[model samples]
Target: MDLHVSRDFLRGGRSLLPRQWFEPMLLAVTAGALTAGGLSWLIGAHDVADLCWILGTVIAVVPSAIWVLSALRHGHAGVDLIAILALGGTLAVREYLAGALIAVMLASGRTLEAAAQRRASHDIRALLEHAPRSARLRKGDRIREVPLSEVAIGDSVVVGPGEIIPVDGRVTGPPALLDESVLTGESQQVERAEGERVRSGVVNAGGAFEVQATATEKDSTYAEIVRLARHVSAGSAPVVRLADRYAAWFLPLSVATAGLAWAASGSAVRAVAVLVVATPCPLLLAAPVAIVSGLSRASRYGVVISGGGALESLGHVRTLLLDKTDTLTCGRPRVLDVIAAPGQEPAEILRLAASLDQLSPHVLARALVDAAHARGLDLSMPSNVTKEPGLGVAGTVANQHLTVGRHNHGSPSPAWACAADNRAMLDSAAVVWLTVDGHLAGAVLLRDPLRKDAPRTLRRLRSAGIRRLVMLTGDREEPAREIATVLGIDDVHSNLTPADKVAAVHNESAGAVTVMVGDGVNDAPALAAADVGVAMGARGSTASSEAADIVLTTDRVDRLADAVTIAVRSRRIAAQSALSGMFMSLAAMAAALLGLLPPAPGALLQEASTS
Candidate 1:
């Protein structure tokens, strides 16, 4: 609970100022009058034939009944109205305190509802305030602070030590290292050379590096996540058609049954008794309270579910369609394994690749560095380096012409075609062709590893009632199928464009609620198309967070199961609360119909019980 909401509770629930204060004081006064009337014969305070009790009762109870009806009715009658009519008319017959107490109880229920609602709104405000407002802008030899909106593409920016990069920029100069965990989830500070991309909102952890801007302000990934927060503020919920139908029937049935009891008994007291227990305040407050509590639990696990409706709908979701990149894997191309041409030592081939790649930022270059580090080799400095984009780098190590790159991205180093028998070994790694002293040496292969938690998360979702798990991606069939198999996913769709992804989301959602998870521009449309859109918060800076229904802050597939569990719990709580209130109301109606009580005394008993 927020401090501001607590203050409001003090002012509204305790003090009840302005018009609210008047009603409570008025009701208490009426209660006093009823007590006097009930004890009139003993007190001897009034003359015989006096009508003080009847007059006071009419004055106090009639308006209380009307106001109570107005508070609960939304253009239609409800069980609460029965309590009002029963007490108001009977109060005219000299029972005043009964009506007053009921009014007070009704107000108390409303106060509780108002405070809970404010607390939820305050939580959202606190979350949005965490986003940064200003960024450090860099222009050649001139460093200035500016609003994030002023940043533009193609401008060079200096990301200094201890400062956050404010816009997406491509590295134009080498640095010792950069901490990109905020954007890429890589544990180590990604050592940067030239021509590598860096996103805004990432912390600089090493020596200062100059980078040319690629995207800025609204176009940056951080800006997009903030936008996603805004869209999910209201939360997705169930269609109101069913709730409307329930409301229509409950009120009429309650009213008709109360009328019949009064007509059969020929006593206004029976009708009053029925009305005493008719109010649905308890049920009305129950559902929202449960939903809010459940949402708090979800926040602990890094999933921010927007509102009561979203939680309720999750109880019934059946199928799940997921986006592959960034959702299941690291989303960065890294070295997975290494292979050497026939008769070549794998260790020698990797050392040569790392030596030449020390100066590059191409996909293959990072893979070589990763491979060397895994083998406990230090990828320090080498001499006479000539690096080029779309071509390999040239360098001398041990008097050898060492080059590392793609036949396309890396310069064509001495080409060593693997003997036919050894070619099969290259398939497991993303082979980066390498050469040394103009002689074919070997190739280094790279791959983005699957998320450490993907398998476990998928299993939990299945246990939690998610029937089908589908993986959709722009990656080729083999990689997509490989990931699906690893994660125990049911269906795999590969080589999809953004438009095709949206179509797939709709297809999977047929007759079931679909949740689509992704972290790139290509996944935005599908996120919007699914019944529930979940963004992997850490890497989702690139995706349209605005389209997602829930944002997974920890950015893990495992949290999906946790999110579903929370939603189901919330719905269950709401249902239990609503039903409990309804059942209590019915019990009151049954007591009233038995002709054991009158409206005035019944209202007082019900009000006292509630308070």
Candidate 2:
């Protein structure tokens, strides 16, 4: 589990050791030197104290000098140049105590930044540990345990109860109850029937079942998620330093001011005082502290931000693009309404239909059965059952003939159920017609309803400064528009392919920072294309999670707003801290120039003002 630190610390090639080790090592050496120097000064061993302080100053200046030279080579002038000058200048003037203090402070700030990066990388690497390593390969009646890497497409894998599914495949036998909370964040156990697709990372919660694999281990869903997670950890970049922008001008200004002070006073000690006070400690430390704090806060709410750059961008998102299914809606179809014909009871119609559907494995059939059970309706077992795929199911329930499904050819025209059909169309629902004794009786309308908290989440997003909300979905225009109207979204782009979604994001991003939220394989490309891609990772496709810049670990969509709120607050606090710290440093520098402060006192005052 090697976690690489950001390139900023590693770019100079000055340190051969791993970047993670650099900060702690520097801190240890500086602390030892500081402690030894203070003890010698207390014992009146002034020469020994000066020697200790010189070691600390030299230790700190070497690496910072390397960093400054590296930046110069790249044509980048960073604020770190100020700290190097302060350390060297103080030592050159024989202000041993001041040089020692500056060295310790510089090392302390670097350690804090390094710790934050390690925490984030640790969080992402956990995904890799939980991935399955092997699968039960079934050849005819015999099953053998084999490494997951050896499994290939079309192989039959036997999954035991309570075991994790190893690859993407379809159920081959009786229905299997699976717990997909690790993938989707939903705690419910879903039953996948024969021929129904099941993804990796799901647990078999019920009886053991067999699956005919459709993808190899390398190409499986969970594998892709692991690959993405690894990439995030290895490629983690340093947050753009808000302080570095000030460094471009501040560095030269500090150097010139120090030169003038020395020329006027005819004392190098006076010049050292100016440089000591001008060090930009706040700019180097405050920005990373604030951003890392924001990342930690977001993680507590089940939102994982990639790095500092993503967090900063999230704080400023002006337009949000949403995917329709599994993002705004539950992605699971449920019975919403049941309309019965004249002289018929809606409950009785549903009871009869559910009774026949109990033996079927269709997704809609399960929805009807669940709905009936929710209403506390007792259903009798159907006899002489017959099924017509994509059409309907017919059987005898309570001695009365019943048929439940879509209307079929040569069936009596549903003249009396025209209102039910119209209602289904308007609501963008799937209608399952119920017929009894050859007469159309009632229709049960099912649709993927909005998540319980979706409306509230949208309201929060609006309050969080999202100026525009647009929905991009592959669903038909009618259904998409219907959902948009319900959600109060002003823009709707329907029937979009993966490429189309990317184009839509690019177009919106031209004017404002756009956030794209999605939860399926088709959403992967668009997720990568957006300014900030948020994946509904709990119970969603792992591909989207892999491509996303931010992932909601829980199933709640409202966390997105929570993350944005944290980002904005963190960035604001960072700006305030950096600007105010610099202001105080400027005032101290003025005092140094006027000779009211010497090098040792100036360094102490600089630290006090920034603190």
Candidate 3:
């Protein structure tokens, strides 16, 4: 079952006595009782020791009784029921010291568990606290500081160097260099030119630049991230369910044993011993501790796990489905090959194509420009540049008309024939034809290369017990197949829309736990549908990150494998701690049932087992 904290629960006011206050109060009472009982015993004042223990037990029992009543009112049974009975049994037998000790154990275990949960929620708190709160509003030639809430859409804002972008906006001035690490978890600085969209929470790494706000602070990407985080934090972890399952069997056994002991020995003392020894402390403590430790390890490696349930699910994932672009490949297209026309130089053809592409905003245009710059080729701006949405771009460079786009469907001449043959060789590469003065000049082959560590990471995932590996991508069949072949993935689903991806994940998840890793806006639906959604947070779209159960803060794909390994190790450790404690408790319970152990010694044994 999907377990989540309802909105009403968060909106509901805190308890009358907060855990912070209650824990300290309970601890102080326990300490006082222990001190008084020891001093009174030394002086041979048995009545004073009994009174001190009774006072501590009363102070502790108040909260325990309240919790049990609350649980019963909600029509549910709680693990605290056993502890409450143990306290009552000890008091009925006049074993005040044993009751006081059991009270201390229960209070201390609850406090520690609560503290671990608070620690695990640090990432969510950090996300909320780090949001930008102000912006510099631009009024013609003057800039005025204003609260982010007052910043509206269409308002011009001037972001200064090292300042966070207060809202999502379009850059209006010179190209701005921004560090988007805070927003996207990418450490690299990205360059945004005029008319390019810039998200909130990214720091301005270069000179001050003007931007026209497209969204208000409350409606910005950072706000969306904060909302998603809150939702994730409210969700319950699977480990909690695992503990409850253990308790389902354990509680009945403990109660039955206590009743059997009472009937056999005809003494309430034997029953009290059984109850004291079977308090379920290990189930209450060990699982959360292991989960918190795993979270700490993930943070050190730049992975932000949303909750303990996500970590547990990731550890047992049987099928792994991943997006192709930006996940397995670099997601950045680059010039791989340049085939020149007969007697035409490759550099000349590239120079012409890059010059014409400078006026377009298409991804291919940026790839061409970057390629030209890397070659140190100086290019002049094209004149009368025009781009047709699905066709190609056209312009005039140095008094010669040029066009770059798909190959025209017609009989190919000798000059175009050579380029066609080169294109045939690269089925996986994106081909852009270069035409100069109405003649086919050459073809530029662009490809988004596979990540260097992808193959090794895939192998490691197999070693970690991921039985099935699949690729689900919106890219064409050729590139998708090419990437799958390189990575040794057995399954490939290409050219799928967002809905198709969701359907794919749902189908896979029906049979086994499925993990979907992606980094784009289109991947959000599929991410949510998977059993465990892992987002490459660095340079990923906000939609995907918000939808993901785990966010890899770094761009390294290998970290995914490492996270799974850590999760598996953590699960094993938690099981070991809990089972070992239970084993010891069972042994102690058997001794207590036979009259070899008394209530006080049984409580001590229970404490030792849990510790």
Candidate 4:
């Protein structure tokens, strides 16, 4: 088949060269060869047995030879080279039975390899199939179904319950409960209020909501993931280097040994024996099997590693640089403490701030409302509430003029600057000033708490051979140090822009393999600059996930430790299997050179060593 035909089959058509086809054909040929050999030994029909064996060998070797030629044309020095040489040498020596047996072994090895590759790559295909193809576009007042390609930016789309979002957009209706489990491996339903951005592929779990499309389907988050998966899969995995380098060394060694045996013994049979024993089957099979097994294990833990190269790099990461916001903290700020005016109660100030913030769409506003509800405080909607995006909210609460926002730049009012405790809280926490009738009333301190598992996760990472753990963030020094000290991370770089973060990762990578963990659009460049970039997928920006080599499907940063452990274990297992196989093959080759092995027996020994 042509390359295009093969690709089409792999994508979504009938298999062009499926294992089923090769497996059954090889089995039938093997059975025929065995029957012919047994009948000839019983009735003395040697010519008939030779003919059946030769025919079976041709049947099995032709397809493999074509595949080898195709691979050579594509500039790939595949492992099939060794199998081709072994089969050709047996035929030249007139060892028909040995040729047939070697053919069966080659076919069985290839079938197993194909099965393992399919198992390892199941997630990529599943991701491709899960993307939505059609969208419900809102034209005027009526909604109509249209193919994703026809949906344009600025078109309004209606996402109903149980349907996947077709494009990136902003919620225009009431708060919608969305199941973003497909994009981020978290199973929780996220509530998206008006003006909040929603990505494609999330399932709308609540009632229908109208979304103003911000990006076309092709540029959506789900489509980018598909493109990234395809690009990564097309590149060769790291273990291919082990197999290629091994073949480069073993091929010439095997040929030279066989040639020397022939010249020494003046017997062609001895040379054929050497070739049979040094087939390199183990090098072809063991490394791939181990890698695929590791990938399967990682999938079970909700980490989608693109390839063996990425996994291998993750295992060797020595310096880990983390973005503080969503990577370490929860990325959501909560009301921690409230300092009211001398005569006013803290509860009264919080009540008024929460009540005014109810009309605001800022993330901190939601935290305030939730905190107020948890404290059993009753809140009422404030009249004349006004919200300025970057500034804060203002309204009339209990017939008193009130404002909640940053303090005026010129000078801090005596109510805040006079208290040492208030200054300390302002230094470490996000402080929002409250004013009543143009006088400073109080301040609300908000803190983005570190993730529950951040400390334990850092400890485990250090144990996994990470020499240096650094925090790189745009936050101020005090808050950054607060998180680093709690996590026992010694290195902290604060007030870093996205460019500074990239430079930090690049510089750290010069000393050792560095890993960058982040989850925001601003973190994309730094993520790409590291040796391996790990994206916290749950609640992470699409840009970050697209740039990251390894994506943790869940929000749990602790899974990074688990991923490192899996990668190390996989690499160790693959190395062990490959090295052990090579040693066994070399020992068998020594026996063959000493005239202790014949063609038939040598083939059996090679197969056993590989197994």
Candidate 5:
């Protein structure tokens, strides 16, 4: 739990304001009245004891009556009706201490509900915080910084190194090295030549360059994603609590039965007995207790369920929609394996390739360097290093010439290198070719590896009653399908924008409870749109985490299965407690109708059963 939430829980599960402190204050007053009344009766002041008990009961009844009336005015009736009737009926019969006990139980229930509902508002600001606020506008030979709104379509914008692209545009002068991972979920830098289109929100990974804007800032891709997120969040329906749903029907049944008891016996006392016995304490108390237990258990397993409502819904999830990038894969490129040609060694090829790649700033270059370091290989410094913009890097290392990059398409590659390329394509991995002394030596294959526990997690979800598994991603068809195939996913939607992901979620959620799990800014809208959004929050973007109903706080994907298990078990326990309590209440109500039980003793019996 967050430190602020922990403080709120300790303070009667609500704010410290007087208005919000009603339930806890009422509980304290009720306890004081019970203690004072007992002492007064023991000292032969029976009248004084009755007054104390009456005062406590009235103080508690007034607010509960008002709340009941307010709920009725909203066209809803809840279990609070039973508590109000029990308090009033006990007071009418002068059973003061019994009324005081009812007040204590009612106040306790309200406090628990208030505490369980303590949560911060959904954070929409995370989506807009990263938006480009300013752009470098190039006006006919003079470049100046301006608000993003001032850069109109057809204007020239200068994107500096490490700066985010501010608008959708086409590169103008030279090839630009851009990282488009935010847009496409591809972990490699792309070289965009003159006349090639580029989307907004990508970072310039190389030297500064100019682009001809084809869209204004508001009309760009990032802005559209922000707009979609806002739309989905606004349109999402509020969760109806499980206790409230049961209260809707249970309230009417108890009221009608009590009315019948009064008519049949022609005595107000009989009706009071019926009302006392029918107070739904189990729904009020046991349900919230079970949900809180589930939330705590989930936290122990590295999942943070937002509230009782989300926890209850998790028990009923059937279809799970997954995002491809960080949800199922490692989200970064890594060296998978190396292929060596005749008379060449794999270790020697990787060492030369990594050594030559040390000075490059590309994402794939870093992957090679990390791979070499992982193997504890000592690298030689390259003297005379040079890059061929869109091709590869070349240098001299320890008296040998080395070149590392993609094989030139215009030139013939060795048969062995060609064979390696074919294998890399089938595996959806990138191939980096290394040439030593003017001959092709080897190839290094790189890929975003699937999470080690992903397979086991899927099986556990099936055991926990997930009926369908689908994947949605901004990645291309080949890579997305490959992952889905490996994981045995039933459906795959590839190359999706934020809007497309939201549409997919809506489609999946039409007649079933759907869970969308993701870990990127691009998933924020869909996270808000799904029936239950689960964010991989340990390394996920803040936007997606804020929009989700449940968050896995650890990097372990298997903990999600544990969350579902806890939800299902908690709900079962709550239902069992409620049903058994209701059965006992029915028997007590029958006894009261026959005049075998009275109001005060019946209230005690009901309280004991629920407790």
Candidate 6:
């Protein structure tokens, strides 16, 4: 077992090395070096200290040398070139103790990096491992446990109340309240009746129901999220050191400075001291440290920034874009209007429509059922039921030939259901047709409810200095325009394909950073194409969330403003920290050149003052 662990460590040390081991080692090395130097000095063992320096220099220089050579051979501009050059030069000049101190600190920094990655990877892994395994399958006269992939469409799967629905299917039982916050971005429990489509991963709240599988396990919603989280996490680039960018020139520049100092001072030691003091640790590490610090702060607020770079860029965004469905609105259709026929009681029409509509699997149908339930109205059992596609519904209720849906504009109206394309009128109303004894009764209009915070969030962003707000949607023009008017969006582009949405994000976007927000399959591409994509209802779509730079765990658009606010704060903090480090480093560099301090004291000032 020990051998296996050692082999694993050797094989995957760069990616898999755990922090508990290395972090302690760094502390031990740092403590040991400081103690050893003090003990040698107390014994007045200058030769011993010199000998210790010799051994440490050779030991440290070998690895740093090898790392530099390998980095160049592989055509890599090493991430820590400035630190490496400064440390290597210090050791070569017999300043072994300074080299040891810097080395231990750099090692600790690596441990910090490893710890941060572990936290993020752990979150992703936890989500993947906790996904449900088996689904309840109903067979002839008995329910059986079966592999999820083996279940086919139209096969009844019994999902117990409070269990995660294993796959997408049409409900074949009584009305159920489903918590689809993870599937959609809303906090409310959704109502679903028989024949209504129920997405996988939604928890059945109170009533257990039989759902005919419409999609398999591999094609399920959770699976898609797992896929997206993995895809969107492509490695992010942390800010590279400015010193490294100048290292080629800085090296030549440092060499010239040292030569000029020595020629003016007539001492090579002062020249070496100049090289030792120009390490650039503060310039290289301060921004990354500040970024990580900001990320840490964000995590406390329940926000997960993918990395430092995302936090940096998100801080500077000037434009905000939103998708209408699920992002700005509740995304659930609810019964809104009841246009009853002459002398037809509104209560009677709704009760009748809700009963039969409960047996149909449609978005609008579920809303109608919920509205009736809210009014304490009950529907009678439907008889001679015949649900014609797109014509709405027709059946014998209380021995009356009742029909529900749009008016038939042509042909014979099923002598019952039947729409001839004329039923599609009233484009604004979410309407459902009703028929009584083959007679057209009336239509019930249904519309999606608006989110309470959307208006305030939109208004606040403009006050928050957002230069423009654009709304892009895959939905039709009329509803989109209506939504735009309600939200007070500055720009609206409706009826766009996923490709079109991506293209639209590209248009009028050049230098200014744009943030796109959405929560659905259609919004995935646009999310990826934007400067920063914010996914709403992230618990629902792993792909969209993963594709987005930011993921909101709760299905609320208010988090959009919160995320922007947090990012801006983080970026401001990073800039301040970085510039402060630069100012200090520059002052120390100036002092070293003026012979104000020797090499050892200069390195100490750099590390101690910066920390």
Candidate scoring better on TM-score of 4 and 5:
4
Residues 1-611 of candidate 1 have per-residue lDDT tens digits of: 01011111134355444533444455455555555655774677554213445544455444445444443453433444544554564454444445544544544544554445546545455445645577666665779878877777667777778777777666776753766554444466767667655666677788787777756677665566556555443221321222233446666666777788879988665665666556555345556556666665665565666655666667668888887756787656676545566678888788878876755534346557656766777554668988543346888877788777544324443334443213424343344667777656676656667878888888888888899989987655777777788788899998677788888988887778888887655577888888888887654544446667777765567777888987876776666766666666677677778866555556555555554
Clashing pairs in 6: 182-540, 195-361, 196-361, 225-542, 401-437, 403-435, 404-433, 405-433, 430-445, 430-446
Question: Where does the lowest 10-residue lDDT sum fall in candidate 1?
Answer: 1-10
TM-score of each predicted structure versus truth = 0.65, 0.73, 0.76, 0.74, 0.62, 0.70
Residues 18-120, candidate 6: write the lDDT tens digits: 5357544544655466557657968998767766544544444444454455546644454345456556666666776666556555544544544544554
lDDT of each residue in 1-611, candidate 5, tens digit only:
00011112225465554544756776788878877987998999999999988988898787677677655665556676788887888788788877877776666656665555332112333435656889998887898999999988678999999999998777989999998655443558989988666777788999999988866876665665554334322110112244456666666777887888889988877888887777766444565556666765665565666666677788889999998766788755788899999998899889999998866644466578778877989877777988663356889998889888756646787788788878877888767888888878899988887888999999999999999999997655788888899999999998677889999999999989999998766788899999889987655555677788877755677888999989888788866766666677778888988889887788677667656
Question: Which parts of model 1 are misplaced by more than 4 Å?
Answer: 1-96, 138-143, 153-214, 231-248, 335-446, 541-543, 597-611
For model 4, what is the C-alpha lDDT against the true structure?
0.74
- Report the C-alpha lDDT of model 3 over 1-611, residue by residue, as the tens digit: 00111111112475556555666667777768967986897899999999988887777676777666655664445456788888889999998888878877876776666566667666667766878888889787888999889998679999898888888777987999999776545578889988667777788999999888866776666665665566654223655565555667777888999999999999899999998887766345776678777876776566778877888888788899999877898767888888888888999889999998865544466578778867889888788987653346899999999998765646546745566555745658777888888888888888888899999999999999899999998666888887898789989998677889999999888889999999776788899999889887655666688889988766689889989998888777767766766677788889989999899888777766666
Which predicted model would earn the best lDDT?
2
Q: Model 4: runs farther than 4 Å from truth?
A: 1-44, 59-80, 137-141, 149-157, 167-199, 204-221, 232-236, 282-284, 334-425, 429-447, 609-611
Which digits, one per residue and each the tens of the lDDT, describe model 2 over residues 489-551? 979998677888999999999999989999876788899999999987654565688889888
Candidates ranked by TM-score:
3, 4, 2, 6, 1, 5
Question: What TM-score does structure 4 among the candidates reach?
Answer: 0.74
lDDT, residue 201, candidate 1: 63
lDDT of 5 at 508: 91
Global Cα RMSD, each model: 10.6, 9.4, 7.5, 8.0, 13.8, 8.7
Worst 10 residues of 5 by lDDT: 1-10
lDDT of 3 at 5: 17
Clashes (backbone N, CA, C under 3 Å), per candidate, total 13, 3, 0, 1, 0, 10
Error of 3 at 474 (Å): 1.8
Off by over 4 Å in 5: 1-24, 39-45, 69-76, 111-240, 335-424, 430-446
Taken over the whole model, the C-alpha lDDT of each candidate is: 0.62, 0.78, 0.77, 0.74, 0.74, 0.63
Sort the candidates on lDDT, descending order. 2, 3, 4, 5, 6, 1
